[model samples]
Target: MYNRIILKLSGEALAGEKSGVNFDNDVIKAIVGQIKKIVSNGTEVALVIGGGNFWRGRSADSKMDRCKADQIGMLATVMNAIYVADFLNQDGVEAVVQTPFKCGTMTEEFSKASALNHLKNGRVVIFAGGLGHPMFSTDTITALRGAELEADALFFAKNVDGVYDSDPNENPNAKKIDEIKCEDIIKNNLKVIDLTAASLCFEQKIPVVIFGLNEENSIVRAVGGQKLGTIVTV
Candidate 1:
């Protein structure tokens, strides 16, 4: 089992295909239950959730400046982090929300040492804000945080079961790759994550496991080393 892990949860997972509402409580708790099992197994967890559920800044019309749009997306993440942390606490898990930008009592300021300390004390630290800047996706933040925190592995609990050779949704012949090297992700221009995130993980020699969270027990199973999906390694 991994001692510590970063869960890169997509905002769509929490949103549950809804367009208007920000979050779906049932989906959030279901995901939390999975993490609860892992935490009960003595694993430390840190989460970096995306903000697509609330806003897609890049899609908000070309009239808006890119930086301003991205900043709106960042605030959406802060909202998610706070809400998720509360849900975790309700489920008997201690959680803290940390942001790269200050949120005035809503969350603690994020730092490697503070986040690590929370993890050590058996609290799930939820990292909010995407690298505290615009023009960066949450995927990149996931890689950066995973490296900074020295996590054993980065768990991308996404919608897809694994990395397919092509778009599985579109291409019926697409095949899932069970195992791959990090460099292959960069070379092949894989969509598992952005290029910057993949490159950073490769540079740090951090292993990434891309798995579908829709399956039962997927989260705990992955942490326990069950190869249910793509295992991207060094």
Candidate 2:
């Protein structure tokens, strides 16, 4: 089992297949239930959320300034982090939201020391804001935080079950890869993660698991070392 892990969540996953809703209460609760289960098992958890539900930097506004779009996207993540944090608290998990930009009581400013302290005290730390810079994905922050926090693995919970040779949505014959290496991911340009983040994970030697969060008991199984999805290592 993973002693410490960074759960990387996409904003769209929080919507939980519910259209026209900012968030799904039941879905969030279910996710929290998984977290609670893992925490009870004595595993340390941290979160990195994406802003795809509200805004995706390159897709939201093609004509807008890149930096501005990324900043707005970053704020979207803060919104997600707070929502998840609130649910975790309601579910009895001690949670805190830390961001690079000040949200003025909405959340605390992020510091390595403070975040580590919270984790040490058994509080779930939700990391918001993507590297506090433009042109960077939350995936990048996943690698950064996973390395800084010394997490055993990075759990990338996504829409798909695992990494595939082709887009499953387009090709019915797409094959799911159970395990792979970071070198193969980059060489094939598989799009499992951004090049920068993938490279960082490779350099840091941080193991990664890409799996579908929608699967029943996915988080629980993933953290329990069940080998749910594509496992990426050195």
lDDT, each prediction = 0.90, 0.91
Cα lDDT for residue 213, model 2?
Answer: 93
Q: TM-scores, in order shown?
A: 0.97, 0.97
Q: Measure candidate 2: CA RMSD.
A: 1.0
Pairs of colliding residues, candidate 1: none
Estimate, for each residue in 1-234, the C-alpha lDDT of model 1 and write its tens digit.
789999998887898766677788888888899888999999999999998888887686878999999999999898898899999999999999998988888899988998999999999998888888899999899899999999999999888899999999999999999999999999988888888999999999999999998888898888899978999988
RMSD of 1: 1.1
lDDT of candidate 2 over 153-202, digit per residue (tens): 99999899999999999999999999999999999988988888999999
Quote the positional error of residue 80 for candidate 2 in Å. Answer: 0.7
- Relative to the true structure, candidate 2 reaches a TM of 0.97
Candidate 2 least-lDDT 10 residues: 53-62
